[model samples]
Target: MANITAADVNKLRQVTGAGMMDCKKALVEAEGDFDKAIEILRKKGQKVAANRADRDSAEGAVIAAVNADKTSGVIISLNCETDFVAKNESFVKLATDLATLALNYETKDDFLAASFNGLTVADKLTEQTGVIGEKIEIGSYEKLDGPFVGAYIHAGNRIATLVSLSANVDGAEEAAKNVAMQAAAMAPLALNEEGVDSAVVEKEIEIAKDQLRQEGKPEAMLDNIAKGKLGRFFKDNTLVNQDYIKDSKLSVSEYVKSVDSNLTVTGFRRVALA
Candidate 1:
């Protein structure tokens, strides 16, 4: 067996981001051959990952990345089994790195399968799960593209939101951030009433009518009362119709118009661990 030196272990650790002990052990197992040592570590990770496959990974970090043009962005969540591990330095870095990699990916499936360093993302997550000794996974991913796109990761990195706007004009970027923040805070059901699912609208109306009936409201007034409740649903649950957080006097639509009359939210996605 080739004696593995500290330099050899550190070099391997730098190359693979594997733990010092793991790197040293792999180097000894591989007779100090660098590439072979990496393979050894990967196999170890694969084994651990497979063994923990059934474990629940519900805690982790949410991270967002945007391009220089501010016209594209991605929000991703890297989940682990424990809050302790989720807040680890290495775990957060892995989340950020995957988010950066998400820029070139069109779908979360492809991003997970995409290569990073010498390993696919899924492989890397498996590898890290071994290193971290936890069940880990990529929980959610969202890609945003439009004239203006912005993302916000709430304080704990447990919630993230991405907002896309129709025009990339003056104040668009700032407006986009405010809207993304609104999304993170208020969690509107849809961008607008037009974007609301018809079935969802029907469900809201039915629930409203049921509540009114339970309150002993007259049957003849049910239709009119439900209609009014439905209108309130649009105002409360739709992004554009909801009052802006900064200035409640204006709807989100009016607040955005204050930025640029032609600018408006085109799409949005919100991901939260809770």
Candidate 2:
């Protein structure tokens, strides 16, 4: 058998993110053929990654990445079968690497078409599917971008949110991320009162008026009832009006009062399992 050098093992480790022993073993198994050794370990990991896919991936991760200047961010939900696999070193590595790839692609089709290692992202997932024998999937991919952005991945990587701000400020990105975290938990519709659709408001008033009339409320009271109901609508749909999950004493709008008034939520995206 041809002697495998330490240099060869290190090279494989750097390329594959596998352990020292695994690299050495792969080199030996491939008879000191570096290229073959790389494939050997990759195929093995791919199998393990794929086999883990079929298991309920409810416990997998939410990964996010931002451009160098924090002008753009990508958030992704990568699911595996169980918390065990979710915490697996290989699984986490794959998820982060995939997130990096996702940052460059705008859509799912584009992401799948992109290359990962020697295989297209889609093919890698397919190969992993075959190996893990579980249902592995890219649950969601979201891109939030503008002049400035921030991202937050909640515990267990189950929830991910990205926010874009209109004006730059100290800790502005982090504050926007808090808002995103609020959106993930509260699921708001509009960033503020003005952002809410007037049509939706009108429709909501109509519904409230109808319900009031059905309840035998006097017509005079119907208008007041409709107005009163509108408050609930705003509270439920508008981010500024919604209760801040972090601190219920203040609405999300109230929380942002200390920040620059111009720092509006230009856009945001929240992702979680269906």
What's the lDDT for all of these models? 0.88, 0.79
TM-score, one value per model: 0.95, 0.73
Candidate 1: list runs displaced more than 4 Å.
none
Lowest summed lDDT window (length 10), candidate 1: 126-135
Instruction: Residues 168-214, candidate 1: write the lDDT tens digits.
Output: 88888789889989988998999888999999998998999999999
Instruction: After superposing candidate 2 on the true structure, give the runs of residues whose Cα lies further than 4 Å from its correct spot.
Output: 1-59, 192-214, 219-224, 246-249
RMSD of each: 1.5, 4.7
Model 2 lDDT tens row, 83-146: 7777777777888899988888889889989999888887677655544455567778888888
True-structure RMSD for candidate 2 = 4.7
Top candidate when judged by TM-score against the true structure: 1
TM-score of 2: 0.73
- Model 1 misses residue 133 by how many Å? 1.2
| lDDT, model 1, position 165 | 89
